[model samples]
Target: MKRLILLLVSLPLLSSCSDQWGWYVVDPTTKTGLTNLKFLLSGLEQTVLMSFTAIAISMVVGLAVALPGMSSSKGWRRFNRVYVEVVRAVPILVLILWVYYGLPQLMGISIGVFGAGVLALALSDSAFQAEIFRAGIQSVNRGQYEAARTLSLNYVDTMRFVILPQAIKRILPALGNQFVYMLKMSSLVSVIGMQELTRKANELVVTEYRPLEIYTILVLEYLVLILAVSGVFRWFESRMQSDER
Candidate 1:
């Protein structure tokens, strides 16, 4: 991964001598470029914060929704299906726009750009998270539930103590994938003026007139962020596996 990143970074430098390519705009060695880099990096905090907040909310919401889908009652199962279908049907961008713009008008309550972005992202992702959780919960062996019943564990207690922990472990990879997806999707919030990584890159492109160079850096930023997140998930998975043994 380090070698790949080095190669990608060096590819542009190899062509730096060409007059057609203006690498000076993002050149770390220069004062202007270094300042621009810092400005771009400044948005990382908002991006990470927003994505984490949204994913956290989504996980809870998803678990709640997933429990209903697992219920034997047809009404509850229908409700779960309807919710997942409706939420997933909407494009995330449209949902973001509506939450930021339309929702405020309808509710007669103001929501800031960050709040709206998080809400929209959480709502949109919760649908998929529900499915992931449902699958994970259902994947547990039937004997686990029988054992819980024998121990006099009620539905809630069974889920809380016996089922959810195992389900969460099984779904950790999916959850991590969702988080990475959240990070990427958070970039869309830039359109609503959240000033995240892509927003910062877009602003810089307007100022520097170097779309290729600026966006290249943006790609690297996301690449590094997602790679780091994936590494953490892998570490957690290893730890969990060791604990199981």
Candidate 2:
């Protein structure tokens, strides 16, 4: 226990050496060299925007797919299963490229880099979210459905009021995890020149000729973002547990 505690305590000190902020000789408020900072910060914002937007779309698509996949109808379930399989099998980066570049020529409608990035992320994330919801829905007791029917609830009403509420409670943690995954995956958007955080880091490296510092800063920003998300999820999980109690 003593050795473990010592090692644990030393971990932060070790990490701080790598991320130690250097002296700031440039004017803090000036926009000269700060152009790099501006672009970097904007990239961070773009990452956040992409993730949140994709997650929003994912929620809708995932739930739509989940509902059909969970239905009693054999045809609908099969259809949804095929969709999930196709999406899950395809690589997301390939999908992003196809959407951004290939689809324009084929469909005669061009999507912007950010739009294609969001679409690709949403398509990928929705498959995962669909499975999450499916598992949550299946975990509900059959007796709950029987009870709701006895109370004169229609199928839709029963799902809306009883099944979904309970399923959502059970799945909240998984849902939060998927959101964090989405946030990290948004960094991939830089491939299509969406000017997200990773792209901004690349731009900074080109201008400042400081690959080490720029990449380090990029990593720190993502670490902070992930930590913030984890903290929020922890708080939300605690509140959910309290509500359950």
Candidate 3:
């Protein structure tokens, strides 16, 4: 809060000096500047929506993939290793390009901009999430499984009632980090024209011809978003730990 207050206080001083620096285009008090600011902020909706949807899908896919890594069957375990290695190898920008273009061409099915964005982001992040879950599950006390067995609990019941809750808490911080990663990576979808924050800035730059000022806000938008998200995650993590204690 103090930092934010300091930043807000410093803005006018920076803007006032813009005249000497010849950067008057971002004078937020001016009509043109205010309009540009609003236009950029409007794009935040698309950015947030795309990120949230992608992370939700990633969590589901990641857990499914992570489970096999813990299986007794060698085939399932090998498949898990192969999946994590192969998927994590792909760069997000390349994945976004492939999903938006090559996927439709090969499958004879097309997803729109938003769908492609979510699909690409989720697929790319799921590999990391899988690893996080795998480690989290493995970190659980082996005695947990023995206790479940002593109770005559089936494997499914064991995971559902005794394992997942603990694993989720252990892995949540990593998951939260993945979400922030997904949020930033969503910008790559701008290349395919999702009209999210980056795309919005790109378009505004073309017309407004003020890349410096426009991009500064663009940076701040993401910075504020990431900070707010990290803070929430930390608070949530602390609360969960408190509950456990």
Winning model by TM-score: 1
Worst 10 residues of 2 by lDDT: 19-28
lDDT of 2 by residue, 29-91 (tens): 666546656667778778988889999999889988999997889999997899889998888
Q: For model 1, how does the per-residue alpha-carbon lDDT over 45-64 read when each residue is reduced to its tens digit?
A: 99999999999999999999
What's the TM for model 1? Answer: 0.96
Report how far off residue 48 is in candidate 1 (Å): 0.2
lDDT per model vs. reference = 0.93, 0.82, 0.89
Q: How far is candidate 1 from the true structure (C-alpha RMSD, Å)?
A: 1.3
Q: What is the lDDT of candidate 3?
A: 0.89
Q: Which ten residues in a row have the lowest lDDT in candidate 3?
A: 19-28
When 1 and 2 are scored with TM-score, the better candidate is 1
List TM-scores for all candidates, in order: 0.96, 0.86, 0.94
**After superposition, candidate 1 runs with Cα above 4 Å error:** none
| Number of backbone clashes in candidate 1 | 0
Alpha-carbon deviation at 238 in model 1, angstroms: 1.0
Please state the error at residue 130 of candidate 3 in Å. Answer: 0.3
Error of 1 at 3 (Å): 2.6
